[model samples]
Target: MTRRLLLSYLGLALLVLAGLEIPLGWIYARGETARFSQSVERDASMLAEVTEENIEEGKTAELPAVIGEYAAESGGRVIVVDRKGIVLADSGAGSAAGPATRPGTDLSREPDIAAALRNQTTVTTRTCTEGGEVLSATLPGSSGTTVRGALRLTYPMTTVTDRVHRVWLALALAGACVLAAVALVAFTLARWITRPLRTLERATTQLAAGHLANPPDATTGPPELRSLATSFTRTATRLQHLLKAQHAFAAEASHQLKTPLTALRLRLENFEPYLDPRAHASLDETIEEVERLGRMVQGLLALARLENTATTPEPVDLDAVVAERVAMWEPLAAEQYVALAVTGVPAGQVWAIPGALEQIIDNLLANALRVSPPGSTLTLARAPGTELHVIDQGPGMSPADRERAFDRFWRASDSHHDGTGLGLPIVRHLTHASGGEITLHAAPGGGLTARVRLRPAGPPPRRLARRPHTAAPSHGSTSATVPGERAGG
Candidate 1:
């Protein structure tokens, strides 16, 4: 933008200079040429008057001497011609006496000389056979109203052209100096205009990066830019306040609800022993619903905490985290008669917030297990490109459900699990917050697949110990399998 502004200013300056300098230069050259022609005509008229006097006195012998002296002084050639179109006195070599005694070429046919013989003074410009151009002025020599001869003076045009060229050269130099100064001023003005915009750009970048604690200064530059900067600072302050209020509300609501939920759970536990055997099933169902609500509240609190705190991602062992989560959830899978398996590449590392990976794995595993049929396998796999996939052999969702899967409190109409619907939304938020992506798709064979792609953090530290791939056995049963060592299933 700065470069564009500078070019625009320089272009305008050049246009102005061209408009002003071109016509003035042409006029100067024309005036100089006209002045030179006038001077030559005046000299020719004076010489013609002197020759007329000599012709009336019949002292034509002194004509050559007079003409030669004038020619030498004025740097021009002179000639005297009678009405008969014959040169009588010539300012040429061997004319030491007078050309009247040894006449030269006829001048009656020459245009300017012919006009002069008719008593009319004429000045004209024409090329010379010898070389350069010449300006010729002819004046009639009259002896008391009778034209006797003509005086023709010729001056080289080179002197006039040289003078015009010098004037043009000086103008060119002056124009260049003015243009240089204009360019310098234009550049300074452009920088002045863009400096504030550059500062605003840097401030905008910082704001986008969540560094709104220090707003940009609004006191510099023109009034428009200053006003814009002030507006941005105010808007950023208002946004900061709004976010703080939202986070405060979420944290307060979650904390406030926890006490009553705990009290209710305690009351339900106390009343469970007094219920009859037939009613015990209903009590257990109520307890489960209460537990689900408690988990939903906890998820909300965790999400609120994540939103309020800006946590930078760090290196984490994807395989190690997955293996640990699988072991923890293995007992529940076994109780449901679902085979829990670990598969895909081993020892992969990714960058994620400290506890985000664990929460995501736990939620996905819980969701998968809840829908898996007995004897069906639930695979916890690490795919290429720093991705993790939880595949379950259960009923999958339609495309419409997958599209809104990340929306908070959204659930499929035919969903079999009793979930609060916050699990997937939390997973999505955490994934994005860590600069990753989460997606749901239908597994290859059957059921749903939850895929999480994360940013890789290179290899794990060498000091970190590798854990053996094994799931905790439930009730002494060993139905789960760790396939080929390379396949890791």
Candidate 2:
């Protein structure tokens, strides 16, 4: 997490640097170039005016000397060309008195001179084969309507290029230094964000391992992580309290229900033979009610154990698990004259507690069998990724009933038999403990379908020992009576 946060911060810093530096460098380059151009333009115009005024005053002899002085002071070159393209005077080169006269010299071949001849100003860059570099500017010199001459000036670009290079190097160095500094700051900030998250993670691991007393320090890290720590601490406290209360209730209730169940079983045993046929039928109903209560108490105890369980999960083949349960429950379904079916077993397995998994499946199947009609079908199947589903062709539960189905002691009023009502609740608790969940919906043939999704098992610690199928006993002793077979009775 700290590495991730640091990467994120550095990425943002690079973005900000790119956004700032590129455009700023371009703007600085343009501003410096423009200012240099303006200075050259001003000096070129001044030189041109000086030559023009001297020529009009009939002081042509002094023009070369005056232009040469200005060129030397400005660190540039100056040349005078007449309207007939004659190179009359030169500043850097010696007096043009030798090869100075020019006519048809084709001065128009030079871009800046041509522009100046056309009464427009021009600037250009050219490299000197000599140990120097220069930028040239040309401006027209006019007396009244007639063009008298062209004034050309050359400014050295070496100084400007050197300055630009220095500025760029400085900026690059500064950018590197800034990036290094920002990286350090980003690492610090990232550590600040991630340290508390690491603590929270360790706390979560401990909580999962059943060490629920200790909580993370909420005052550490950033605001969001700190808030999360506070929330986890509060949640752990509440959960611990609730679990203690539930365990106490389950233990107390189990103790209380034991006496009633024992007394009810004794009474039913005593009344089994003494009463007439009608009285015997009522006694059977009472005995069934008492057994249902006993089952509910057992379910409560199972749920209580789940609440306090600290056992780590292990790998189990869910297909074989569901298959075994189906086989065990088949006789019971047959006795009720319900068609029991199985489908969709995958070769995969799941990580779960074995007992919890079995109890969950049993409760789902038992509930479905209780509500379904005699000829109705019960389907047990495995879905994708180690999920088991138990479905029945019975009256589908309403939305409200489905929502409340997992609450302890929940029972539909339409149920025909006496039920413990804690079956679904225990199923839910055990499912959660095994890192899975169960959902119920209407089956295709107008019945309840309970779908269980589970986590796939990892590799096992050792090989499983093979056992005989009969070793896994069926739930009931009597053979199933088909629905039609009992119609004549």
Candidate 3:
């Protein structure tokens, strides 16, 4: 950005200098040349008058002396030619002004001299062999319309060229100074504009990290950016306070809500033995209701904690987690007389929040196991992409139910009444938080298939410890059911 801005400034400055200085320089050059030509022409006319009478009278002895003095003072060559096309006086060998030339030479052959003999004056610049360029002026010395002689003056054009060169050099120096000044000013302006933008960017990053210690410097830069910074700061302050209150509420409610419910469950259970034998069924049903309510609270609290925290994703071995979870759930499958197995090609590492993959797989397997018929099979499968499939040979849901499966407390019409409906919502929250996606579809052979798609991760470092291939028996039996399979698959 700074480079672009500086280049724009320099470009505009260069154009302005070219527009103003080029024409001025050209005009000065032409004017200086014109003045130089006029000077020589004026002098030629005066010299013509001086030698006109002498040449006509055919007494030219004093002519050479006059030409010599004038050429020495003016650094030019002077020639006096008579109307008969003969040179009467020449500033050649006697004067250090021009090449050696003898008197009585025909001068009318020269273009300027021929013109002058016709009673015309000519002024022009031309190339010369001895000198680079010379300005020559020829004026006729006529009396009463009769041409007596001509005076021809030749001066070097270097005098005019040198002045024009100096003017161009001066313009070049001025242009360079202007460009330098523009560069400095442009650099300052660029930095000024971008500094506040950088500040806002850093502030946004820190805000997303949930640790914005210092907000943007809204005191500097353009008014628009300053206003943006100020508004962001105000909003961030309010959001931080709201999140703090929510965290505190979840923490406090976790303790307050769990204790009383736990006490109530124990109270209800203790009365079971004292009740009449016929009332036992009612007591058991009440106890079950209390337990279900407790599970709902736990699921809700889990969601609250998830929402309040931000965790970065890390690489997890996809195949290893699937294997471990399958083994862990195999015992329950055996008890229910349902087969649990892993199928499909091996999936490699995938990115997920820490501890999230384990929870996601456990919940999905639990729900699958709950719905499977006694002779049915529960499969944890993988395919070409970075997606996992939990397919069960159980009754499948309609498309409408599948769409609303992620909604809190939503359940299929045929599902068990005991379902708390929080499971699928919890699963969704975890999946989205890890930057992955979850969807439900009908399996090929008529069963519900829950598919999770996640980002692939780079291979783990060789120096890292290897994960065990199988699930350890020490894992809690709670791994068997995804929130009692009440969790949505």
Best by lDDT: 3
When summed lDDT is taken over every stretch of 10 residues in candidate 1, the lowest stretch is 480-489
Candidate order (lDDT): 3, 1, 2
Model 2 alpha-carbon drift over 4 Å, by segment: 1-85, 88-151, 156-159, 197-214, 218-235, 263-288, 311-313, 343-348, 372-377, 381-400, 432-437, 444-446, 453-489
Clashes of 1: 2
Task: Tell me the lDDT of model 3 at 344.
Answer: 84
lDDT of 2: 0.69
Q: Cα deviation in Å at residue 42, candidate 3?
A: 5.0
Number of clashes recorded per candidate: 2, 5, 2
Task: Give lDDT tens digits, candidate 1, residues 334-353.
Answer: 89999889888774778776
Provide C-alpha RMSD values for all models, in order: 8.1, 8.6, 6.4
TM-score of 3: 0.71
User: How far is 367's C-alpha from truth in model 2 (Å)?
Assistant: 2.7
What are the TM-scores, per candidate, against the unseen true structure?
Answer: 0.72, 0.63, 0.71
Reference-based lDDT, residue 44, model 3:
90
* Model 1 spans > 4 angstroms off: 1-19, 44-110, 117-119, 122-197, 311-362, 374-393, 442-446, 449-489
